[model samples]
Target chain A: MSTTSPSRWKTVRSETGRALTALVIALAVALVVILLTSADPGAAFQTLLTAPLSSNRTMGLWIDDVAKLTLTGLAFSLVFQARQFSMGVQGQVYMGGLFAALIAMSPIGATPLAIPVAMLAAMCAGAVYGFIPGYAKARFGASEIVSSLMLNYIAILVVNYLIRAHLAPAGTGQLMTAKFPDTAIFPAILPGTRFDLGIVIALVSALAVWFLLYRTSWGLKLRLVGHNPKFAEYAGIRSSFIMVSAMTVAGAFGGLLGSVFVQGRAFGNLAQNFDGNLAFEGILIAIVARSRPLAVPIVALAYGYLRQGAQLMGIRTDVPTEMISVVQAIIILLVASSFSLPGKKLFARLRGQKSANAATPEAAK
Target chain B: MIELLLTVFSATFFVTVVRTTTPLLFAALGGLISDLSGALNVALEGMMLIAALTAVIVSVYAPWYVAVLSGVAAGAMLGALMAFFHLRLKADIILVGFAVNILATGGTVFALSRATGGDKGTSINLPSKAVPGVDLSFLEAIPAVGPTLKSLLSGHSILSWLGVFMVFAVWYFLFRTPYGLWLRGVGEYPAAPEAAGIPVAKVRAWSLVASGALAGIGGAQLAMFNYIGFTRDMTAGRGFIALGAVLLGARHPVGAMLAALLFGIFEALAIVMPNLFNWIPGEMIQTIPFVVTVLALILFSYRAQRARQMRTLSKI
Candidate 1:
């Protein structure tokens, strides 16, 4: 036990080192952007470091962002865990939001009575949107990445057309539906913040996903299918069905995120491209967490804080909030990298592998 | 509808189609190169956006050709960076490509604001130069056919002619050259080439660089010739359409050009249709190319599958 403990500790240490390296590199790049763009780099960096935690109000804002990002991240984790790279999470979200609005606005329903119905309709729409690509991949040998990406553009445009044609109130001067009813809007739970019960739903769903992935026999079979599809088929597992269901489940989570977005009180209307970055953010969060459901919410919160801080930095300093995108990209590159300096032997292999990466970064020129 | 179709087939419409097709063709060729070398460049959209901004910004201080070269250099550097992460650091190629895309999306906005002194929406405020259109007025001096040819082909950007020449060039390089054979071998079965002492990774690296350079030129054409200014996300879905074109073209250079022209015709139609059909929303009309991409891909895949099954049956 003692001997094994040391080896385990070493692995833990290396993992920690790699994570820290990614953080350091990402932050350093962000800082360089700040220095280059801002007149007062010190103040800019300070706000970036502390603005998310500066006040209860800021904290609430950060957590509200985290709630939505967590749900989207959960949506991506479902498909990613099955070894299927579905790029349709945003597409599903777009469908969900549009369907949710349509159902909520239907004449047959009372105001409060329609919210749950809207959520269900949204989930169904998302499922259908996901199923198209799922079926294509399962039956036609088409690439999920390409099909889903095309679907995303279609979904966005279709939703945009729907909003303008049927949903938008006359003379609004913008392509958005009218305000949702009071019953549709989620109220703030925290006194001084936009934090709402939507977060509660997201937190519960993350825990539920964790349980479903770790403690269920279905999870085991699904993982087996992902680990080796041919072996799973030999073992009588319906791998294609699992693949489709994984996408369906993922779509459901995306739907939930959209439902939450539309139900906010102050900003209850869905706007153009409001679903921006959430899909990619979901992918990034899953990558950071190694696609573990339990770790997703944590990564979402961390990313949420950075985004909030970046926004604050934009307001307080000369920096742009878009800098966070560059930071996030670099973080993803570093974290997903196999290079590490923890072990001397491992370090040598990393150095020897590339003229681009290790020998000369200037080789990119 | 027949009258409308006839009206749409004028020299003006054909010229618009050629103009739209040039950028798509360049990007499609770029996609084809990387794809043939076993690296699908999903980052074409981002590369084009960055290069568009780069070319537009550089055109303020340099010659049009120099600005275009700068854009190509920027894209090549981005491609090299992607290879660093994908090949050396061992990240998934798609994910790395996506990261570059995300970086481009934000980085371009930040850079635009800096360059334009606060405008984030476009580079409209800059005094950018455009690629000169060729004047074939001499065709008017020749004869009867000269007037027709001048109307159809004259006034096109010089880049458009290069784009046409590039189609044949890419075809010859891919089908008639040793390096092209090596690239195909590397993509199909890298092990065979590796055993034969070819540097598979190096080939892939150079293919990505070439891919990026070509896409960069496409961006330059979009900003410097087609549109004459840079807008955020102006490449729009053209990069993606180019990818679909690569597949729809059956992954061949000549096919890529034809596929690009097909989409470009729809895009040209979109540009003109909104004025004619006042009732249909412009956004809805703009989706024609993307919708066509999906339908064409589905049809292509279904047909390919049936063909494969038939081939197997014949063997039996």
Candidate 2:
């Protein structure tokens, strides 16, 4: 085990290689599909890969999208680390948006104080939402997956109802809330684009999450609990408490993203089409990042770029934009399966006994 | 009021329940077989969705049965993909299931558009074939109860009868065969069978394929018989509901059938309740099936825990 410590870079390289392998497979599949359907697959692929870098505006939009995806991905990584599969990030985000809307509409405070308060309110709402499943799982042994999933639908419906009944703008035909006040919006950092201070917040939150999960005592205990509840119990850690805390933190992060989106881009207005695939996209990002907090931003950026490219692909080609979704699915399948590649044998020889220890994490559940 | 009461007791309601239950029953059986073999088949929703679309598209050019078979084959192919990732490539089964679901959600819409020249929804414009209904009108000539029996049990899609047959077929496959024992042993503890030289990965792979094929049949029934065409998201969470039914049914073929029937009755009511109660919102009525699923699952978990507690107390 001690001898393996010096080869950390090798581990990183191999993991990076595996992720790239998955990306290559996705690209290969997309190429085949494009060639079959379009008159120019090579041009389409080139457009997808390079369109974001072609213009400053496109680059800014790409950054904004990556910021949102990264925030949600971080949220997922936090909860998943505790071995709780909470699919409630979307629900939490909805609540956060609602809180932001309420605050924006209210005349409670000055602009500077109001924005922070609204963001905090959103975070609190998200934390409470997450706490429900965590408590249910710890106390009653309810499946978090089912509860979290059910809550997502409930949240979406409730938000839709609210937007239609009370939050609708005076003359709007569709179910959407009124535009928020200028003061409620986040200050734009990049001119001529939606890019705002939210990117900074997301990056700061990622760092905070990294610190919490790796540098803090509570984080250690949580990881122990996740690795083995029985072993953690023997070590005097309260596994249930850790589970609840982790979920709460995860939900808070999700809420923060929602608040950021509402305050920055949508101007605290809710729309009926707000069932954005952000939560599911975040799940995919978490998988591609292998649930690593630090890796989330990189994966999110890649996804954001792919999404933009796919949209462009749709415009330039006869292929539907859903082809991007197919690519995403393929990426997930390949990345999740990359561990079983034959090349793993080479690493196995170098690590030897330590490789067996790694197997424990796979069986933790 | 009296007429409504009579209608409630009439054969139409019974037939409606059976019709609604057919797809759900098939999906539940699919879910059950995979779950007992430890795979859980979370992609049932996606498989059903894709297969539904496939059945509708293929039925346009082929016989209804051939269309259904093609749907099943498509589902089996997806199952094989999942097996390749899960058993061969060592991917997480749940994640693989989710990937399939995400793919199905987006892929079907893409395919639907391509097939319908950018229609993006309900294959209503497509000239799709319908599964034939079994006419038991001959039963009316037999006896005093024949007319009632014919009305209550006849005129269902031939697929519904096949669904009933599948329930027994799945039961026999899981309990009465040597392969069944091997599959069960693999699910419960793979090491035991691995020691016995039975290929655990192969069993899991086959189970996944069988699961997908069963789900495909359910999808075919939904498209070809239930509404005579495919619609985007027509499976709507039926696959997930079937998953709950798997657990609520105590993981048995009979239990799964009953559970599916219970959900089917509620679904049929959701379809009928708007006519009966003009005051309630349609959206609220549409929520009945999801609400029922969550409640049923909660009740199932509570009962299971109670049973465990009772056993512990008895032992003490």
Best candidate, TM-score: 1
Q: Model 2 segments beyond 4 Å from truth?
A: A1-6, A108-112, A266-268, A339-365, B1-10, B142-144
What local lDDT score does residue A267 receive in model 2, on the 0 to 100 scale? 47
Model 2: per-residue Cα lDDT at residue A200:
83
Per-residue CA lDDT of candidate 2, range A261-311, in tens? Answer: 788763446676474676778878888777778888888888899887777
State each model's CA lDDT, in order.
0.82, 0.83
Model 2 chain A poorest 10 in a row by lDDT: A356-365
lDDT of 1 by residue, A40-84 (tens): 999999999899998888888888889888988888878877878
A146 Cα displacement, candidate 1 (Å):
2.1
lDDT of 1 by residue, B1-316 (tens): 7756875878999999989998999999999999999988888988998999999999999999999999999889888988888888877777788888888888898899889988889899999999999898888777768888889979998889998998888888988999999999999999999999999999999989999999999999999988888998898878888888887788899989999999999989889888788888888888888888877777787778889999999999
What are the runs in model 1 whose C-alpha is more than 4 Å off? A1-16, A107-112, A342-365
Q: Give a tens-digit lDDT track for model 2, residues B1-316.
A: 6755666687898888898899899989988888888897889989999999999999999999999999999889999999998987788888899899999988898889888988887788999999999999999997899999899888999999999999999899889999989989998999999999999999999999999999999999999998889888899778888887887898899999999999998888888888888767666677788778767777777788889999999999
TM-scores for candidates 1 onward, in order: 0.93, 0.92
